[model samples]
Target: MSGRRLAELLAATETQTPQGGQAVSFEPLGWVWLKAGSRRRRERTEAGVTRMIETMRVETRADPRLVAGRVLRFDGDDWTVVAVEVDAERPGRVRADLERRP
Candidate 1:
């Protein structure tokens, strides 16, 4: 799909050197058009507690800098990227699977 819709902003976590120590910061990558979907799944943690997790599928234009750990903000909600898959047929597009962070 053409990137004609502005849906979300991609933010990357950056480490900055400030004062005598390092600090973590969120840097805005850019605005991107995205197609999104949601599903619910049950996840078991290390403590053996089962919890419901909302997973989101987000598709957008391909960006080499977009990785699995970055955060995506859309519609006042933040989702963490869990996987990124580049579209094989359409080389300029990428599909990122995301999970809502508790």
Candidate 2:
């Protein structure tokens, strides 16, 4: 996925409870490779999982200065990010892959 999408996903995967309950974290299941001559496959890794969780946290904060992307993924849909791995792109930018069930 592109950096824009990743930023969007990260911003959407987060939610705030009534009184800011234990921040729920959404970890990336894995990436499904869409190959040309073979069936799709998924490769899960710790780094991916970590990125998923961190992005959620970064986007779900109380700061209103953060900018979130428009990329979104619904539940049951397969998605992954290859580039733009982290949410440290620039100031006031929350990097994330917005793949969460609303």
Candidate 2 global lDDT: 0.32
TM-score, predicted candidate 2 vs. hidden true structure: 0.22
**TM-score per candidate:** 0.70, 0.22
Off by over 4 Å in 1: 1-25
Model 1, C-alpha of 43: deviation from truth (Å)? 3.1
Q: Point out the worst 10-residue segment of candidate 1 by lDDT.
A: 1-10
lDDT of 1 by residue, 1-102 (tens): 223335545666557576666675667787777877655565747577767677867788887767888877776677788899989988899998878745
lDDT of 2 by residue, 1-102 (tens): 211122223333556788976564554332221211111333335755632221222132223323343333433343233222233644543333322222
| Candidate whose lDDT is highest | 1
Over 4 Å off, model 2: 1-13, 19-39, 47-78, 84-102
Model 2 lowest lDDT segment of ten: 30-39
